[model samples]
Target: MNNNKSISVQNLTKKFGNFTAVNAISFEVEKGEIFGFLGANGAGKTTAMKMLIGISKPTSGEAKVAGFDVYKDTEKIKKNIGYMSQKFALYDDLTVRENARFYGGIYGLSKKQIKKKTNEFITELGIADIADNLVGSLPLGWKQKLAFSVSLIHEPKVVFLDEPTGGVDPITRRQFWEMIYKQADNGTTIFVTTHYMDEAEYCDRVSIMVEGKIEALDTPENLRKQYGVDSMNAVFLKLARG
Candidate 1:
């Protein structure tokens, strides 16, 4: 997996005032891999992800995302990655195509490229009828899907999803994961964070954070076996008890 390493974290740490949000975590994400980042509330998963994505600088240690150093090359790293936060980062007042244009422009996508990709995304998502409709008029599921597509408008090498399926129904979550799988199959590295243990099984490999440390990391099968548990929930229960 050496050549496949798309993101590397080494003893990364982040602090706020006197509290340590992310405490010395290290890991690597391979290219074309669906890497699951799992954690409970206040476990520092989001903090670690922020540092990796270059929005939050590490307090100590080092990290490289898409081959750019987190400390000094944030701009370069920004160009190589796309991000979708749980809060749905989109313009509610803008139409679907207009929203796409706004995000595409921010990522420096050429006008021609944005037009081409917007058409393709609308056709694939079967949302051409509402292409000109304001994003606020769309359903939650449709907005989530469109936000994902817009994030990738620049064709970034890596995409980070922070609880991308947070408020969706079970069916929509399933559908969202399917889209993530398609992108992974197309050679895009997917670094996702989720609280759903069931969704963790769908990842190529998963890492569980407990109090800002990677307490468990492996394929679903191996993790279950190692914990002597039949399901990820049981494994998580055991870990949480410790």
Candidate 2:
């Protein structure tokens, strides 16, 4: 296991009954790198992420996340990682401050730490005025940003984002990416799954899964050149069609 790598997997596989969701796939994510996990629906992206995040157990092969073995150290993995699903997992009824406190408690943060962090986060995001408002009343983009902040309350080593920018306007998406870039700059490895090809361009490296297998893995520029395409959309179309 390389100490500098945040995630390492070799021939990692998962099956449901007789169907193999993720075939023998191998990959490594370096510390602070923005790794893009791309694939069409049912292409095994979700299944693979579940295994890496320590929620879904693999049927065979070896894998490690945040330097902990997936088979034995799932609890540790969960503690050292943050996850923001596509659904924007925030309590709609809770106020911004309450949500922060809720997640902080779950991550075993001290009350003083939670208060300090919450103040910093709200001030940083410029949401201090609405800290007491119900989350359901905030705009979608604000909620998305808030959820992301909550995910980082414990300062996890890695953050997994599942289509995090879905349904947001172009400006909101760009703003979200800026936040992602800031996190990566601070040494948090970001492993994200997305269907948006345009977003793929922002990744340091991307792996495209086709039919439960990683058919292509490389930087966006290299992939475009290798496939003789002008954009990631075309690159994905060319590979997914085959």
Candidate 3:
């Protein structure tokens, strides 16, 4: 009940007609925590995330994000959270500067604030020479980084990332994670869904979903040790198979 927790859910469920997409589930994430959400394809992780982010109403549950109730304060939840998806990072046709300006404005930044942040982004991302160039022209790695920075334009209390590093190289993913660690260090709660086992190990804690239910929730080291496995991947496989 304390507001210090970034996310809290109780018996959250979502159903499409007679079929339940996300079974009743509950969890809590502390402020500044990196919570890894893991599941196989169609395991209901996305469905549950939708409810937590206030995108989809839960069938029956009580949930809160950033201290705002998901049912009564859906709009408030949206304002306090940043979201980034691997599928669509940014508009390719828009220039890097334009994309930043657009997202900053969408977040309700004043013209002056947008200008200042846009210039900061240019300098920080080292895109000063190509600030006017189309975002499509940048490398995939740069685009992902830019997308991430833009998501934080409003300094959200929490961020939700869906497979943020799908096709990037190991070096780029490492760099992206460094950025993640920095944000968490600054007291931003990060709720991320990733298929990469190595990334899962970086989380303060991880919840693994199976068949619309949470099969395991614990630290990576604990999960491995509890299951008598050497790696998170092995723990996942052992749980998923059972």
Candidate 4:
């Protein structure tokens, strides 16, 4: 394992019965890089992410995350990664402070650390006045931002964000990416999956999946230039259609 690589996979495969969910795929994500993982529905992107996050085991081949082998060190991998689903996982019934405390406890953070994070969220996010308000009462954009901050409470080495901005408005999406950029700048490896082609441009590097395999992996500029397209949307449409 290379010390500089946050995620490393080679010939990684996941199968169920006779069907292969994720075909043999290989790639590496450098530390502190924002890597965009894209794919259409049923493209096996989620399956591949599951293996990397230690949610599910791979059928064959090798994979490593945060310097731990995926096959044997699943527990260790989980401890080093934070995750946020596209659907958003914050507890609607819990207030901002309560939710932070809840997740902080789950991560084994001490009371002092949780209090510090809650105060940071209240101050940094400028939501101090509403810190005690229920999360469900907040706007979708607000919840999205809060959920992101919660995921980093443990300060994991890598974060797996699955389509985090799925239904957010443009302004919210931009704000969300700013937070992402800040985290990346702090040396956090970001592994994000998004359907919005424009979001692809924000990534340092991107990998597009098709039929359970990574069909294209490169910077957005190189991808556009390679496909002779003007936008990532066009690049995706061409690849997804073909």
**Which ranges of candidate 3 are over 4 A from the true structure?**
none
TM-score attained by model 4 = 0.98
Determine the C-alpha RMSD for candidate 2 after optimal superposition of all C-alphas: 0.6
lDDT of 1 by residue, 1-242 (tens): 36679988889999899998888888898999999998888999989998888888899998888888999999999999999999988899999999999999988889999999999999999988999999998899989999999999998899999999988999989899999999999999999998888998899999988988889889989999999989988878788667
Decoy 3 TM-score against native? 0.97
Rate residue 115 of model 1 by lDDT.
100
- Pairs of residues clashing in candidate 2: none
Model 3 accuracy (lDDT, Cα): 0.91
Measured with C-alpha atoms, the lDDT of residue 94 in candidate 1 is 99
Q: Which consecutive 10 residues in model 3 have the weakest lDDT in total?
A: 118-127
Q: Estimate each model's TM-score.
A: 0.97, 0.99, 0.97, 0.98
Estimate, for each residue in 38-78, the C-alpha lDDT of model 2 and write its tens digit. Answer: 99999999999999999999999999999999999999999
Q: In model 3, what is the error at residue 148, expressed in angstroms?
A: 0.6
Cα-based lDDT for every prediction: 0.91, 0.96, 0.91, 0.94
Kindly give the number of clashing pairs for every candidate.
0, 0, 0, 0
Q: Global CA lDDT of candidate 1, please?
A: 0.91
